[model samples]
Target chain A: MAVYTDITESELGAFLRDYNIGELLSYKGIAEGTENSNFILHTTGGTFILTLYEKRVDRDDLPFFLGLMDHLAQRDVSCPLPVKRADGEIIGELAGRPAAIITFLEGMWPRRPTTAHCREVGVALAKLHLAGQDFPLQRRNDLSLPGWQRLWDGCRERCDEVEHGLEAEVSDDFAALEAGWPADLPSGVIHADLFPDNVFFLGERLSGLIDFYFACNDFYAYDVATCLNAWCFERDHSFNITKGAALLAGYQSLRPLDAAEVEALPLLCRGSALRFMLTRLYDWLHGPDGAMVQKRDPLEYVRKMRFHRQIISATEYGLQQS
Target chain B: MAVYTDITESELGAFLRDYNIGELLSYKGIAEGTENSNFILHTTGGTFILTLYEKRVDRDDLPFFLGLMDHLAQRDVSCPLPVKRADGEIIGELAGRPAAIITFLEGMWPRRPTTAHCREVGVALAKLHLAGQDFPLQRRNDLSLPGWQRLWDGCRERCDEVEHGLEAEVSDDFAALEAGWPADLPSGVIHADLFPDNVFFLGERLSGLIDFYFACNDFYAYDVATCLNAWCFERDHSFNITKGAALLAGYQSLRPLDAAEVEALPLLCRGSALRFMLTRLYDWLHGPDGAMVQKRDPLEYVRKMRFHRQIISATEYGLQQS
Candidate 1:
């Protein structure tokens, strides 16, 4: 629900002059991608996505995010490749914000994730990690352990407005994650936020993954752990072990995790849960109410974090010992 | 910005099974059309618009609206044809709401309409009227004078909050319109709401008119007058004679207005302006403060109605008496 910037026809015609895509036939603000304003563009050439990177996205990270898509598309990973201009520039300016056009990927993100969808996403996740290994640009995961604590500090005083004992429970979880956080085992570009909404599915097959704004250099297992927190949860906050097992099996089919990486899944999952909870908590406490932006409940992640705190092994999450 | 009805994958799949359209490739909630929830659905066959009629639309009016589109499309009016199911039904239930899929029209509604676009819409409006002559359905324009008076009574008390002495000014305007309103002058189907957003264009050529929720039986000249209010006003609320003339000239080229119709243009335009103002005034005083639906400034139409009041002849609006 975002079309913050308005582009006039003459200005848009001038902008499209840089690309080979033919004259604009039609374009509308699409209700997709919360961080940036997205418009589904249909031109004489073909359909493409016009993204105006909003304030939430770092202007400096434009190169890395767009470049990663360009790099990964050259490989076998199915994702939206940034459409380059005549001079080979991928990024351009529109409505005074850093804007770019990417080829429209043809698939819908599943609204309700089945066990099969979880497994397919895991396989695609592993595939993205493998394809991203040789990518040149590197961005450190900012929503890691330290990032979680930093986000928590902003919301600590009023976190209980959302829940009675949420503040203390989250603080203790952060302390445990900081002490036991994994420093090694495997590292590469991971889609740190590979939720189902970011993964497109056409029928039973995986079509592509999107929203590379959160892609960064991070532990591969941590990425998998984020998937556990995101994909394996039921509507009532209970963890679905079948979904967990299927997702892990699908990932392991492509790239087998080492013993250390396997053991760190529980802690990594807990840390990932805390990372999301802290940011959501920040938005929950501060987001402008009644605006078009849908505010997610931070307490959903709180329950998941508590579930991870009790996990003794990856086997509990439907993983077989490697 | 409307997708009030949330459709799941399985539910969507089951719904699509009822139609002959092939497998669903992608479906995205489009931020277009205020009355209904619209999603641009892509399937193996081709792209189409899937609209779920919201509470704003009357359930019984579905047959008339859908039948009008069906009838007009058959008559070469260039409107979206409702896709019928194998059972030959245009309407179906999805997400517990009445839904239907219409053929996707290719073109963008001009954000800043030029005189050329104005002319194109004028020609198209006349063509729609002439084409709709033999259509069986007859829907009274409820949003006409009677509707305006009913709406104004509801908001008359609070209308002053929007403007100083607005109640008196509007009351006087209403009294004048009721006294001078034309009883007959080329009656036919009129698109009661012909705002720029409902009119699509390719370059300066009018691609098609859309959002037929307000389509009903009314004076043809009144519809032309609504266009004058909608398309001929500048952002500053000043009337652009070039636009008004172009639009009226375009309409007359296809179906010439009678001398009486020509004489009634100024009064009809004023009445049209008041109609919109009353509705917008009601919403302005009543719209939820933080709701996503944008409440239009009622003063815009007040200013437009005043401008129309000063006009002496149809020639002043670029119309020549035939």
Candidate 2:
């Protein structure tokens, strides 16, 4: 529901002159993607996606994100590649916002994730991590431990407006994660937000992944923990052990986790859950009234955080020990 | 921005089992169409639009609207044809709402319409009217004069909150329109609401007209009046006579308006303006706060209503006399 910047025909026609894609046939504002405005573009040459980077996306980080997609696609990862303009620049300006066009991927993100979907996503996630190993650009994961602290600072006093004991619970979780946070692991570019909505599929097969705005350099196992929390949870907030086992097995088939990475899984899961909860809490409390952007309930992640806090070992997540 | 009903994968798959369309490759909720929830579905066979009728559209009117589209497309009107299910029924139930699939039309509605676009829509509207002549379905226009009074009744008290003297101005308009409303004129199935958003175009050629929820039996000249108000007004709310002339000229080239129809254009335009104003006012005053449905400004129609009040003859709208 994000068409914040309206592009007129003449403006679009002017913008398309820089690209090799032929004359515009038709274009529509897509109702997906929350962080930025997206449109499905049809041209005489081919179909593509036109994305206008909104205020939330940092303009300086555009090169890193676009370059990662370009690099990964070259390595045979199924993802949308940014289209280069006639001037060899991938980014352009339209309707007073930074905009770019990318090749459109054909698949729908699974609304309801099955065990098969979880396993395929785990395999795809491993492939993405391996493919991104040698990428030149380096972006710090800003939503990691320190970034979580900054986000928490903004909402500490008023956090109880959402849930009664949310503030103290979050504070305890932060103290535990900060003390036990792993300093070193196999770090690479991780799809930091590989939620089901970001991963596309056709039937049981994985088609591609999208919404790379959150990709950053981080611990690879942290990415796996994020997926364990995101994909294995049922609607009732209970973790499905079968889906968790499948996801871990699928990932281990490609690149098995070391002892240290496996040992850090529970804390990583709790930290990942907290990161999402903090952001959702911030948006829930501070989002403008009557905004078109749908606000997600932070309490869902709160439940996940509590579930992760009780886990004693990776085996509890149905991860088998070697 | 209207995806009021969310359809799950299993539900959508079950719904498609009743149709002959092949396996569903993907589907996305379209941000277009205000009256119903629309999804652009891609399948192994072809791409199509799936519309779930919302509460705003009467359930009984489904046959007339779907039949009219089927009727018009068969007559070479170039609109979307309703796809029939395996049981030979056009409508089915999905997500507890009446739903149907229609062949997808290709084209974009112009954001900034030019005079050439205006002329083409006039020609298309006239073609639509002629094509719908022999259609068996008969639906009275609910947004016509009587419907305007009913809608106005809900907003008359709070009308002043929108504008200082809106209530009195609208009351005087009702009194005048009731006394002088035409009893007998050329009548047939007319698209009561032929706004620019409902008409799609490829370059300067009109691709098609859509959103037939408002299609009903009414004066054909009144549809022409609706188009004049919709397409011939500049951003400043002033009438663009050149565009108006082009539209009337394009329409007359196909089906010339009779003498009585031509003479009644000014009042028809005013009545058309008031009809839209009343509906917009009702939605403006009563629409749920924080709802995704964007409420249109009722004052725009008020301006158009005032502009049409000063129009004395069809000649002012560039209608040439034979």
Report model 1's chain A TM-score: 0.98
Model 2: pairs clashing at backbone N, Cα or C within 3 Å:
none
Clashes of each: 0, 0
lDDT of 2 by residue, A1-322 (tens): 6666667767898999999999987777767888887888878887788999998899999999999999999999999999999999999999988999999887878889999999998899999999999999999999999999999999999999999998999999999998999999999999999999888888779999988999999999999999998999999999999999999988998989999999999999999999999999999888933366788989999999999999998998989877
Runs in model 2 deviating more than 4 A are A288-290, B288-290
List where candidate 1 sits over 4 angstroms from the true fold.
A288-290, B288-290
lDDT score, residue A96, model 2?
89
Cα lDDT tens digits for candidate 1, B1-322: 6766767777888898889999998999988866788999889988899998889889899898999999888988888999999799999999989999999998878889999999999999999999999998999898988988899889998888988898899889888989999888889888789899998888877788788899999999999999999999899887898998889889989999998888898999999999988888877888833355667888888898888999999898877665
**Poorest 10 consecutive residues by lDDT, candidate 2 chain A:** A285-294
Candidate 2: give its CA RMSD in angstroms.
1.4
* Predicted model with the maximum TM-score: 2
lDDT score, residue A29, model 2? 77
Each candidate's chain B TM-score? Answer: 0.97, 0.98
Candidate 2 falls in which docking quality class?
A: medium
